[model samples]
Target chain A: MDTLTTPQVINSEYLLKHWQGHRNLTRKVIDAFPENHFFEFTIGGMRTAAQLTAEILAMGAPALKSIVDRSEEPFSENRFNLETKAEYLTKWDESTAAINANWEELSAQDFHETFNLFGLYNFPVIQNIQYFIDNEIHHRGQMFVYLRALGITPPFFWER
Target chain B: MDTLTTPQVINSEYLLKHWQGHRNLTRKVIDAFPENHFFEFTIGGMRTAAQLTAEILAMGAPALKSIVDRSEEPFSENRFNLETKAEYLTKWDESTAAINANWEELSAQDFHETFNLFGLYNFPVIQNIQYFIDNEIHHRGQMFVYLRALGITPPFFWER
Candidate 1:
């Protein structure tokens, strides 16, 4: 077992906390959405946040599981199936749990190894992991703006 | 120079390219915003992309310079002063160049070292760097929704 396999470039624990913090913040944004708007509210031609949440759920656990199993599944957009906002949250929790379970299997060294993410882009494991976080954060930002548009006060950004 | 001051966790080269890539992508998003709505468009009371862009510029170059120079400046919201969309773009370019200049002074160890960001949060350099990227990505996502609301096609996310 080589020590460099788990490089200390970014502390592994910090990475875990960082991703989870963003997740927590995102969940709050979801909670703030009015039920009526969850499925129907959309800006421009973008997918509603419900659809976007589906996309996040599709990407998060599935992507991490793929990384842990050393599998490169083809990329796919999440299809909206849930009828209620609660159903979406239920799925989100399941995915979060899955990420936790799979995260334990990812050694620090794995973060440095290059892997094809969903058989789409080939980049180092760390960058691939970042893509997951970045994508979610991006969507979450949109959710925040949505809340404001609906005359809602969303949680502070740094709360997570 | 002791190498302890420049540990190699993540490749430094990759970090530079990653941040710069996001910046380029963000710039394109700015270009996509219509002049009339650049300052006026607001979703749910959220700041328009133009205002958000100003916040990014304030944080980007200014934050990095503080890190390199070891100063602790308080975080301030971006003030809306530009009368035209072109002025906002010019300021953004200036900030981008400043980030490039300041980035060189940050060594790998700096990523691990802790400093108070904007005199608020105290975290390692890497986390702070991640903050910069994450915040911009999040805002950019909002901008995407805004563009979509306006029936404009934002540049692809991965194009950066």
Candidate 2:
């Protein structure tokens, strides 16, 4: 694998598009949950979908902003205070916009630079960004099971 | 985003490493499962952990092999007939090796080529490969919930 000869597989734009595609599917997952179940449902003592969403919400734009600002803020999921599913959807939209805005501030070289994500998880900037998408997918997977358990089918995983 | 100007963020080697990291974490998830629960535990009418593992086992190497052969075999999860946790572990190792072997056969240009995955998903070969990782993480998330339900702590997601 000669780095100089190998063609690049994806660019930052492609990476953002791919991440957003997962976000779109995840928003659908959020929409599919019954309002009550969104906050109250649980399986085997796992966190409710709301709690999981909060963790995801806490990470994305904040992490990106941290990278852009070179700020090492401690990670916290309690930043958002919301009492309803509608509130979560609103916050999700805001975070989506924030991610795009923050993304533009990053140079291609920034991806190779190390950033301590949420003041922890020291890694290359790209890996941290990938982790955001991976984490969302992971949580959304749990929501899929939650939906199924509630007798609802999740949006097709491949549709994204 | 100018396609010509943007630097590529990843190559085939990086993609493989990122994916194998998830596989490593997921393999640990499997190892953490109690044998009986691996085969039979359920929450809210979901498939057991073993069933989910079977679906993952069915996809990874088989999909890569399909791309390498240009053979659009219909997707099937019943290919492996393992009945125990240890058997699944053995098969997982085999599939991991198979993935590495098939990966070597794919060129940088192949990532941009379109292949009908499992004769189902008609997308770029890269997206299909990505689905393999996404699907594994999704199932692993469910297993995480299952582990919690069983009073077990899953491996840290970031450790991957």
Best by DockQ: 2
Off by over 4 Å in 1: A1-7, B1-9, B78-83
Candidate 1, position B68, lDDT = 93
Error of 1 at B141 (Å): 1.1
Prediction-by-prediction clash tally: 8, 0
**Per-prediction CA RMSD (Å):** 3.6, 1.9
Per-residue lDDT over B122-157 for candidate 1, one digit per residue giving the tens place of the 0 to 100 score: 997777888888889988988988898888999988
Error of 2 at B35 (Å): 2.1
With a 3 Å backbone cut-off (N, CA, C), the pairs that clash in candidate 1 are A5-A109, A6-A109, A9-B9, A44-B148, A44-B149, A148-B44, A149-B43, A149-B44
Two-chain DockQ for each candidate model:
0.42, 0.58
lDDT of 2 by residue, B119-151 (tens): 888888888888889989999998998898789
